[model samples]
Target: MHSSAVFLIEFGAIILGLGLLGRIAGRLKFSPIPLYLLAGLAFGEGGLLPLGASEEFVAIGAEIGVILLLLMLGLEYTATDLVTNLRTQYPAGLVDAALNALPGAAMALLLGWGPVAAVVLAGVTWISSSGVIAKVLGDLGRLGNRETPVVLSILVLEDLAMAVYLPIVTALLAGVGLAAGSVTLAVALGVAGLVLFLAVRYGRLISRFVSSDDPEKLLLVVLGLTLLVAGLAQQLQVSAAVGAFLVGIALSGEVAEGAHNLLSPLRDLFAAVFFVFFGLHTDPASIPPVLLPALALAVVTAATKIATGYWAARRSGISVKGRWRAGGTLVARGEFSIVIAGLAVTAGIEPSLGPLATAYVLILVVLGPLTARYTEPLATRLSRLTRRHRPDTSAGDAPPALASEGPALTVDPDTAMSGSATHMTLPPSRGGS
Candidate 1:
């Protein structure tokens, strides 16, 4: 068969599988990440077929996915949610990244990879699956809840850490050795990032000016700006994800309601193409020899994120059940990890590590949805344990099930920042870029 035709068949098959298996996973109470990963495996390297993947297409879709995902995330950033609660959340976000990154890197080193490959592996493992978290939260109808803002903020912080760390790591891989120049570049990027944050903070000028219901105008302007900024960031030797995220952040307010109309169609089409190409890249037969190591790495990656994220979430003052739910929700690795791993591969960081990274993501994606599918039941049990241990406490303090409505939004004299956009000024809640 012609490559193009085979590619289309594989793409169609994947989409079909995702939809069907997603429903199946829903019924089985399993997370969908594992399903997607399994789909990749079945259709990819070791499966019944291969598509001879195109790195370019997958990379682009992954890029846009991060942008759209983060754009939506940023719009949720009201003044109260982002600005007023930094002291605690910011530190906790750093801790979350550190806790995940350090252990994963150590594990990689134990596998005999040196510091550079280990670090790259660590970055690949460090990020949690934001897409899975968002899906489960929305399904539980908790996407708009107060805790969501906190979780979203932490995810944002992780992205920022990756944006900074990626360039430094890339430089090291290139034999730049983390010199003064790299440090200076990192600092400059931070300062520039702060400027971007400030613009998002007080500058409602763009949103107030060009906001519209026209999807074409919005997509062109919003996506064009994202691409431009992404290009600029690349010129500066920074991660393009940073630039794309900043563009999304700046346009968050203007695009929130109409975002689906503008980006969803294009996102769906392009993203499908992206995944198809991603599947085609691997020769599944080649993965057999490394499967054990990959599985081992994947297990460590999931455990580290769950344990550390749970600990960090708890320390951030979330309830025990909230912590477990958050940690479990984050257990999946998705497009972002794949993007970074692909980058590592392209840059020649280490030949073997690239497949290892891909294998790790595939494993996590397959397992994530299965875990998330049953999250509520598990959360209920955990919440019960907490309640039994302390019966006198109000239910309001604990994370409630999705079937229940949370405490009615109430005004607190001590904490007057209600759900208004003005209240969203909580210091760029936990985004990475």
Candidate 2:
């Protein structure tokens, strides 16, 4: 009885504090993620005031938070959309993985963390924070930009990749033998394929069965199904998050929208708790030793993400500025990074890995919004400065390819949002390079 009371009081205080922090973040037009982590640091082990009664509850909430995050991410697109993106934008996705995932893998191996840890860290660096990037796009009013589709395509590819990657990590972390691991991988892939097929073929029926005019019933049904499926997937070593994501993909139309609305608040609450939970496990003292490496990794990965985006946008014939904008927008790695690292932490892989990931995410998440806003302008300014210092060349000296570089085709946000952006093409220009 005494413990229950303490738990309630502590949990209530933490919730209230989170509310205040969230409001402050809203007013400042920044992500609350960093603030949440700082709060956790202050209230965690070896901090000013460590949490006792609510720590376990926070951990559970954190897991739910990840499930909900992936679920809603799945809800954003239909299975057909996924197939279309995979077919059309695969080159960009490949580039994205190569440029972004490699650095983290290299860093992990350099640190002598072995192959499993390397895979985990590679995922940590590979994915951009969909939540943060979405919010940033809306805030910056760049949702309609020509490059936004390119940005989102890369993100979608990453999310789809996670559906496979998480299961592999689970098998690795469990130290499963070759035959068992093969079975696990096969099951995961087969299940993913079956879900995608059913979703494409009969998504309407699935949504109709779950949907209700009553929002309360709708919410309960969808949430219940998601948890059930997630649990079963975990039992099969396929990853609960992936299962929740697949459930979401199977839901479409009005049902998906309704569930998303009903769960948004819960997602926000639990997601905040998730970030705090990650911070809690990480010793504040451990961060400094890893801070330099984290910063270096951040700098390198940021550049690679930018390059990936720029290359993708350019391939699609976007203007130079739009390419830069796309690149900058891809630089932030938030919840997903922590999610990947959290797996390694739970497996007790490397003590320093958690701190390194925490520091890396902290640096990037805060820097992400700033980059989304300024990278284009910064690049433009540098270009002008470089031009001013360079020797003047005659018109004929300019390369033909440079002269033909033209304005990119513009796409409405709705069109790109709908996955019809595969048809978008750039127009050739006879004007300036």
Candidate 3:
């Protein structure tokens, strides 16, 4: 009875605190994720006042949080959308992997952790936070922008890549040999392909089976199915988050939409708990030791993410402003980065990985929204400044005869940079001879 009472009080207090933090962030026009993580750190093992009874329950809730996060992400699009993105946006995905992932791998190696740790850290840096990015887009009213689809396509590709990447990491962390790892990889691929096929071919039927007009029944059924599948996947040596995501993909139509609405509140609650759970495991004191490396990693990866986004958006023919916006939007790494690092930390890979990842994510999550809002204007200002200070090289060149006749031959930054214009007008040359 005493334990139950303690659990209730602690859990209730957590919920209440999260609500207040969320309200504060809303008022401040910012994300509450960093604040949520800080709260967890404060209440965790090394912090001010750690909870006794609720820690176990919070752990379970955190697992559920990860599953729900992946599941809801799946519901955002159809199987067709996934296929289309994989086919068309694969180059961007590859670029993203190369630019963002290599830095983490290099860092891990430089720290003398083995190849397995390198692979794990690679994933930690590769993925962007879809939840945070989506929220920012909605908050900033950028959903209708020309570059938004480009951003979403890249995000979807990354999520799909996780379906494959997570299983490999799981196998590596488990210390499986080549034959066993191959089998595991094969099974994971088969499962993923089969789920995609079913989702594409019979999604409506599957949704009908799971659907109910009654909200209570609907929530129970959906949540139960997700947990069951996730558990079984784990038992099969596959990642549970992948299983939950597959289940989400296999549902469509009104059922998908209904389940999404019913489960959103639950997702938010558990997701917050997951972030806190990550913080709980990380010792705040450990962070300061690795703070310099983490800060360096954050800075390097932020630039690479921006480059990846800029290249992808430019390839898609978005305007200059849209390209910068796309780059900046992909800068934040939140839940997934923590999830990857948590797996490594749990596997006893490296003591310092957790703290470094925590600090890195905290820095980027805070910087992400600000960059998304300001990157374009900043880039524009810098470009103008560069032009203003550039030395003139056309002093001896003759001005074009059409320059005076063609409205001064002004160039639109977007048109010129996007390569959409057929003709370029040389800047009116300085008079010579």
User: Candidate 2: global Cα-lDDT?
Assistant: 0.89
Q: Against the true structure, whose lDDT is highest?
A: 2
Could you tell me the C-alpha RMSD of candidate 3 in Å?
8.2
How do the residues 290-369 of candidate 1 rate in per-residue lDDT, one tens digit apiece? 67887887776667666755666667676655566566666787766766665666677666675576677778776775
Clash counts for the predictions, in order: 43, 0, 0
**TM-scores for all candidates?**
0.73, 0.91, 0.91
In candidate 2, stretches whose alpha carbon ends up further than 4 angstroms from where it belongs are 395-433
Worst 10 residues of 3 by lDDT: 424-433
lDDT of each: 0.61, 0.89, 0.87
lDDT of 3 by residue, 1-433 (tens): 9999999999999999999999998899888899988988899878888878999999999999999988888777778788888888899999999999999999999989889989998998899998789889778867656677788888889999999999999999999999998988888999999999998999888999999999999999999999999999998899999999899888877888888989999999999999888888888988898899889999999999999999999999987888999999999999999989989888888888988888989999999998889998899999989987998687458567745565466554443343322222221100010
- By TM-score, the candidates rank as 2, 3, 1
Clashes by residue pair, model 3:
none
Question: Which residue ranges in model 3 land beyond 4 Å of their true spot?
Answer: 392-433
On lDDT, the stronger of 1 and 2 is 2
Ranked candidates, highest lDDT first = 2, 3, 1
* CA error at residue 334 for candidate 2, angstroms: 0.6
